[model samples]
Target chain A: MKYLLFLGCVIPYRISSYEISARKVLEKLSIELVEMPEFNCCGLPLDPVNHELMLTLATRNLCLAEQKGLDIMTLCPGCAGTLRKVNKALREDKKLKELVNGFMQEIDLEFRGGIVKVKHLVQVLAEDVGFKRMREAIQNPLTGLKVAEHNGCHVLRPAKYVGFDDPENPVILKKLIELTGALCLDYMYETECCGAPIIGVNDKIPLHLTGEKLRNVKAVGAQALITVCPFCHMMFDLNQPRIERVLSEKFGVPVLHYTQLLGLAMGFSPDELGLEQLRVKASKILNLN
Target chain B: MKNHDSTKPNSDGGQANDRKKEFGRTEHKIVLKASDLDPKFKYKISKIPGAERIMLCFQCGTCTADCPIAKFSETYRPRKLMRMTQLGMKDRVLSSDVIWLCAACFTCIDHCPQGVEIANVLRALRNLAAKEGLMPVVFKELVSNIRNTGYAYRIPELRLKRRAEKELPPLPKANLEDISKLFNLTHLSKTLEKEERQDA
Candidate 1:
C-alpha cells in the first residue's frame, strides 16, 4: 500500500537514520512511502492557543495526502496524535469540518471524510506487516539482545484523543521489540516523558531526566532501547552525551528506532538500516561485523 | 574619619588614606537595594485554552511548593509568574527567564488546586520570549540555526566522523523547512520585531 511519509523536523537532520531505517523496513514489508513535498510543521505547537489552527494545519497536510489518494504514515508520535486528533475532529464535527474545509479550499486542498488513515510505524508493522510476514523476513534474528522500549509520551497521553494504547502502561513497543527475537526487559521510566518539551526552554531538566532514563535502561540489563517517536529518539539518542555530562553519569546505551531494530532483526545490515548516524554508537550493541 | 597618612595613592587615583583611614571601620555599612517590577510596564497574559485557568492563581504558593525542579533551582516559580501575568505586569512576566525553566512534566498543572496550566503558560511565555529575542544568546542562536538548518539538535561533523569510525552510519539531516515555514506562518519573527521596536 502507498502512504505519504511525514518526516517532520526531528527525523531527517538530527536523527536521519530513523528515516532511512523506517523506509528500509517499511519497504521490506511491501509498503511504499511517497515523500510529501513542502509539508510544514503539523502546528501541534499551536494546540495550546488555537486548537482550530492546529486542526487547520493538520488538515492542510492531510489534504495534500488526499490529493495523492494515499494514506498518511507518520514516524513522530506528536505528528501522529496531532493528525489523528484533527482527522477525528474534522470527521465528527461537521461545522468544524466545514470551517477547516473552507480554509483548505482557499489553499486548493480538500478533506473528504476518512480520505486518509494516519498510522504510526509500529502499527504499520504489527498490522500491515504482521508478525507472520515479519518472521518470514528475518534473516539474522537478534539472538541475545536485551531490549527496553520507550513508547514516548505523545504516543500514550491525552488518551481520550489518540487512544493508541493503555496510556499508563503501553506495550506496543515492547511487543514490537519482542518480534525481533530480542529479549525485552522491563524498565522503569519506560513510559516517562523524555523531557522533549523543555529542550527549548531549559536544556538542563531534559538532560537530567533523559539521563535518569538511560541509567534505568542500563540497570535493566538491556543492550539497547527501541523507540517509535523521533522526538524521543532525539532526546534519548542525539542528546545522550549532553545528558551524561549534566548527570555526571555514564550509560553508553544505544537507542534504535523500532524500525531500525526490526530491520536489523529482519536480516538487514547496519549500513542498509542506516545505523551509523546514532550518537550512541550501535556497534557495541549490534553484531555488525 | 579623616586620614592621618596621605603618602600613597588608591586604585581610583585618590588617596590610599580614603581606602583605609582607620583600622576600625564599623561606621561604614554596605547598603543593598530592593528592586521591584518597572512601574510603567504591565503584562497582559494572552488567553491559552488549557491555561485559561491560570487566571485564578492567588499566589497560594501551591505551585511553587509542589514543583520538583523548583526545590533545587529558584529560577522558576509558577505562582509568581501567574500572579505577575494576572496583574498585567507584561514585561516582568514575559521577560523573566523563569518561564522557560518549566520541564513540561505537567506535575504542577496536574496538581494545581485551581486547575492552572502552569506548564502550558510557561511554554507560551517562553515562545513569546523567543519571538521577542528575549531568550538567552545561545538559545536564540540555536533557534536561528534550526530556522536556517531545519534541525534543532546539533551534531558536529567531526564528532559524527569520529563516532562513525566505529562503522556507524553518518548522521542524516532532518528536513526543517516545515519548522521555518511554521515560524513564518505564525508571523513569529514579525511579532517579535514589533515587540522589540515597542520595547526600544
Candidate 2:
C-alpha cells in the first residue's frame, strides 16, 4: 500500500528515530512511504485558538497529500488525530470547508474533505501490514525486554471522535509490541496523562506528569516504555531530566518509540533507526555492535 | 463572597451542628490547622512570581473547548483548571492528575478568549507540586531516570553497540554535574525551600 508519510515537527527534529524506524518497518512490510514536502504544522495547536487559521493550515496539508493521490500515514498520534479530525469535520461542515477553501485559494490549493484518508502507522501496520507479516519479518524477537505501552491521549479520548482504540484500556499498541515477542507489561497509569498540554504554558506539568508515567513503567519492572506519539515520547524521553531535577530522585526506566523497538526486532541497527539523535542514551540497551 | 465561618451557627439549623457534636464535638468544632490544608496547594496563577496575565482570566470555557486532549478526556479540562487556579484552591488543582495529562498541544493557549494563559498555569502548578513532594510517585521516578541517563528511556548496552554498527551518533552519557545544573535551572529547588519554611 502507498501512503504519504507526514513526520511533523517532533519526529524529524526531536524524535528522528520514530520517523526512521517507522519508515524502515513500513518498507520491510512492502508499504510505500512517500515523503510529502512543504507540509506545515497540522494546525492542531491553532484550532482551539483560531478555527479559521487552523482550517486554512490543516487544509493546506490535506491538499498536498491529495495531490499525490495517496492515503496519509502518520507515526505521531497527535498528527493523525488532528488531521483525521479536521478532514472529517470539514467534510461534514460545508461552511467551514468553504472558508478553508478560500484560504487555500490564496495558496493555489484545494481541500476536499474526502480527498484523503489519514491513519496512524500502528493502524496501517495492524490493518495493512498485519500481525502475521510483522511476526515473519522479525529477526530478533526482543524476547527479554518488558515494555509498557504509552498511547497518548489524542489517539483515544473523545472516544466517539478519534475512534481508533478504547480510551480506557488500549491494547492495539500492546498487541503490536507482543507481535514482536517483547513482553507488554501492564501497569497502573498505563492510560494516565503524560502532560503534553502544559508544555508551552508550563514545562513543569509535562515534566512532573511524564515523571509519574515513567515511574509507573519502572514499578512494573518493565525495561522501558514504548509510545506511538512523538509528543508523548518528548515528554517522557526528552523532558524526563527536567522532571528529575525538580523531584530530587532517580528513575531508571527509559522511553522508546514503538517503531524503535520494531526496528530493533527487525534486525535494523541503532544508527539505521536514528537512535543516536535521542537526548536519552538508548544505545546502552541494545548490543548491536 | 461570604467568608465560610464554621464557628457561626449552621445556616441550615442547630440540629445539624447538634448531630455533628453528638457524633464528635471535634467535628462540630471544624478543626482548622495549618496541616489540614489541601496538601497539594496550587498557587494562584496571578499570584505566582514572574507569571503574568493570570488576572485576565474571565472563567471562559474557550480554553477547555479548544484543548485537543480535553476533547478526548474530561480529566484534562483546561478551563476548569484555570478557574480553580484563580479561586486559590491550589490543593484541588495540584492533586489532580488531569494537569499531568496535557500533551502541550498549545491548542488551549491559542483559543483562550480572555487571554488567560492556561498552559503556563499548569506549568507553575507542576513546579510547585514537585517542590511540595505532591507530584505523583511515577513522576518522581521518571525525573530520577532522566537525571542519571539524560533520556527517559533505559537504553540497554546491546542497543548502544548496535548504534555503533549503524554509524549513528553515540548517546550522550549523563553526569551528576549536568543533572545538578538542570535541577538548579528548574528553580524547583527554591520552591522546595519556600514550602518547607511555610510548613515550619
Candidate 3:
C-alpha cells in the first residue's frame, strides 16, 4: 500500500489543499506515501510544443520513481496521463527507451521500463482501497448533499494509455462519491474539459468552458463540485470569481477536492482538510456554520 | 424558382450587380491554385510526436461535432484543420490562429470514429507553428515563464504566506539548474532564446 506520491507542479505550489486532503485520507487508509523531491514537471506543458522533450521530462520522473522501486500515485490527471503515456511508449518501443535513456544519461538518471506503476489518486482509492473498506470508514455520511463530479479530461481520456476507467462513461469517481453517501448529481457536460489546458494561452475560452460547466452544475441544484485534479480545481474553484464575471452569472457552487469530501466523511474536521483555503465556501455543504 | 428569385436580391450576385454599376467591375475574388499545395507538409506533420495518425483521418467531422470549443466558436473547427493538414495546406494550417485555438482537451481524440488523434495533430501543428515563429505572443510569454522558473505560473508571496497560515508544508523549491540543463539539452531554451532575439 506504499506509493511514491507525485504531486505535480500545480498541487505543490497553487492548490495545496488537494495534497493536504489526499495525504490525510491516504494515511487514514494505511497507504504509505513517499516523496521524491527531484521530480520535475510531468512535461504536459511542453508536450504540444516538443514531443520528445515532453517524453524525456516525464521519463526523468519515472526514472526517479524506479530508483525508489515504488509505483507512483499522482494527484494531477495531467501528470498521470503524461507519465502513463511515456511509460507505455518506452515499454513498447525499445529504441525509443534507448533514445530517452541517451538524454537521461546527461542528467545522470536512467529509466529501466516496467519497474514501477503510475496510478491516479482516483484509481488508488477506487481500486487499491476498495469502496467497501472506504464505506466502513465513513463516520459522517453526506446523506443529502448534492455534488457534481468533474473527472477532468486527462484522467479517463486517450483510453489506450490511461485505462483506469471507461473513457466515455466513467463511473469510478461517481462510485467513490456515492460511497460517501453523497448524491452524485448527473448534469449536462459532466465530462467536458474544464479548459485548464488552454487557460495559459487564452483566458476567454477556458473561462467560457468553465462557466458553461458551472452553469450546468448550478442548474442541476448541486451545492458543490467534486474534483480530483488540481488544474480542474483551479478552473472551478480558484478562478470561480473571474469565471462568473466573464460569463455575467453567479454560480455559488463550492468546489471540493475528492479528498476533502472523504476526509469529512471520515469525521475529520474541515480545518483538517484545509477546506477554508478554497475560494468558494464549503460550509454549507459540510453543514459547518 | 420564385423562392430563388426572392433570395437573389439578398445574395452576393445582387451585390455584384450593384458594385458593377458603381465601379464598372466586381472588386473581390478568391482563387485556390494547385501550386499552393505543399506535398511535404503531411510528411513534416507525421514526424511530430502524437501525430503519426494524421493521415488516418477520413474527414468524418466527428472531431468537430464532439469539440466543446467548436460549439461556441465560429472559427475554431478541428475537422477543417484535419482536412487542411491532410491536403498539405501547410501555410494555412501553420499560419492560421485556429490551430492555436484548440483547447487540447482531447474530446475529439476519444470520440473520433477513425481514431485520428485530432487534438495531437493540432498540437503538432502548434509545435511547427512555434518553431516557425508563428506562435502567438502570449504563448511565448508562457514559454519564457517556464524558462525562468520551472513552473508555468510563478508562486506568489501571498500564496506562500497563506500556505503557512493554513499550517501546510511549504512547497519544495524546484531544482532550476537541472531544469535549465534539461532545457538546454532539449533545445527548448534555444526556442525561447530565438523568440527573445526576434523581439529585440
Candidate 4:
C-alpha cells in the first residue's frame, strides 16, 4: 500500500534519524511514500496563537493530499493529529468549512475534506503492516532486549476527535515493540505528555516529565526506551543527559525510534537504521545477531 | 485593587481569606468582585469551536488532575482556568501565565466526564489573548518563522546541506505566497505586526 508521507517540521529540522529510519522500514514493507509538496507546518505549532490560521494552513495541506488521492501519513503525531482533526472538523461542520474555504480561495484551492485520510506512523504500521507480516519479516528477534514505549500524547488523547488506541493504556506501540521479539516492559504514567510542546516556555516541567519516564523505564530494568513521535524522542533522547543532570539521577536509557528498532529486526545494521544518530548511545542494546 | 492586609477581610467573607491561604501569599489573594467579571464571557467563548462545551463544565478538577504540566507546575491549573472562564473571569484568565503552560497533551479532554475539551478551551482563551497581543515569546518566534519560511523553526543551512550526505530526500520547499496570504486572511499578520512593534 502507498501513502503520501507528511514529514512534518520537527522530523526535518531536528529529528532526521526518525525520517531516515522510517523511510527504510516502510520501503522494506513495500509501502510507497510520496513526498509532500507545497506543505506548511501542519498548523499545529501556532494553533494556540491563531485558531483560524491553523485551520487554513492545515486545510491547504489537506487539499494538496486530496489532489494526490492518497491518504496522508505523518511521522509527527502533532501533524497527524492537527491534519486529521481539521479534516474531520471541516467534513462535519459546513459553516466552519465555508469560513476556512474562504481563505482557501485566496490560495486557489478547495479541499473536499473527507477525500484524504490522515494517520500517524504507528497507525499506518499497526494497521497496514499487520503483526502477521511483521512477525514473518523478523530476521533477528530482539529477545532478551527489554524496552519501554512512549505513545506520545497526540496519537491517542482527546478521545472524542483523534481516537484510536485506549488513551489510558496504550498498547499498540507496546505490541509493535513485542513483535520485534523484544520484551516490552510496562512502566508508570505510560500515557503521560512528554511536555515537548512548551519546552522554551518552561523547560523544567518537560525535563521532569522526561526524567520521570526515563527513571520509570530504568526502574523496570528496560535497557532502552522506544518512541514513535520525533518530538517525544527528542525529549527522551536528545535532552536525556540534560534531564539526568537536572533531576540528579543517572539512567542511561537509549531512545530508539520504533523504525530503528524494527529495522534492526529486519536484518538491517545499526548504521542503516540511523541508530548512530541518537544522542544517548545504543551500543549496549544492539546485540541481536 | 491592591489589598495588603490578609487579616482585615471585610466584605467578600472568610472563604476569600481561606482562598488566599491556598496561594500561600498575601498579594495573590485576589477577591472576585462582581465588577471584575463580564458575566457574558462564557457565552463569548462558547461560540468558538472546541469550546462549545464550555458551559458543561461543573468546576470539576479533572483537567488539572490529568494535566502532566500541572503535576510539576505549582501555578498551572486547568480546573481553575475552566472555573474562572465559567465565572466570566475574562481579563484575569487571559492574562494568566498558567494558560500558556498547557502542552495540549489533551489527556484532560479524554478524562473529562463533562465532555469539556479543556485543552481546546485553553487554546481558545490563548487565541483570544493573542488578539489582545498577549502570546508568549516563543509563539511570537514561531509565527515569525512560519510567516517567513513556512516552517515553525528555521532549519539551518548546514542541516539542509547534511540531508543529502545522509541519503535523505530533499526537504519540501514551502509555498510562502499561500502561507503569507493565509496569515494575512487569518489576521495573524496583524498580531505579528503588533508583537514586533512591542518588541521594537
Best-fitting candidate, measured by lDDT?
4
Of candidates 4 and 1, the better by TM-score: 4
| Residue-by-residue lDDT tens digits, candidate 4, B1-200 | 12211123221213344556776666455656799789999999999988999999997688888788888776677888898899998877776666778899988888899999999999999999888887777888898899899899899998998899998888888999988899999999898788678768
Alpha-carbon shift of residue B21 in model 1 (angstroms): 31
Which model, 2 or 4, shows the larger lDDT?
Answer: 4
Two-chain DockQ for model 4: 0.51
lDDT for A168 in candidate 3 is 77
**lDDT of candidate 3 over A1-289, digit per residue (tens):** 9998887778866899988898898889999988776656778877767677788778888988898899999989888888988998899999889888888998888998889989889988888889888899899888888889999788898876677788677898999999988989999978888777766545777788889999999998988999998999999999999998888899988999999999998989998998988999887777632
Instruction: For candidate 2, write residues A110-209 as lDDT tens digits.
Output: 8876878998888888877888888899898887777789887766654655676676678888999998878899987677667674465345545666
Candidate 1 chain A: worst 10 consecutive residues by lDDT? A45-54
- lDDT of model 1 at residue B21? 55
lDDT of 3 by residue, B1-200 (tens): 01111112222213334545666655344333579789889988887667888888888888988888776665677887888788887876676666666766788888887777888898888787677666666666555656676666677888888878867666655667766777777777777777778778
lDDT of 2: 0.65
CAPRI band of model 2?
incorrect
Name the runs in model 4 displaced over 4 angstroms: B1-25
Residue B167 shift from truth in candidate 1, angstroms = 18
Residues B8-96 of candidate 1 have per-residue lDDT tens digits of 12221122223245432321242212244443322234454345565677677877886655543534567877776666556555555
Candidate 4 residue lDDT tens string, A1-86: 99998988898889999988999989999899998877699999999999999999899999999999999999899999999999
lDDT of 2 by residue, B1-200 (tens): 02112223332123334446666664336544455344333344455522356667787688776554554442456776766566565665555555555554444554566655576566666655555555433443344444455343445677667556655444434344533343444444454455457547
Q: What residue runs in model 3 are displaced by over 4 Å at the alpha carbon?
A: B1-29, B161-167
How do all the candidates rank in terms of DockQ, highest first? 4, 3, 1, 2
Interface RMSD of 2: 13.9
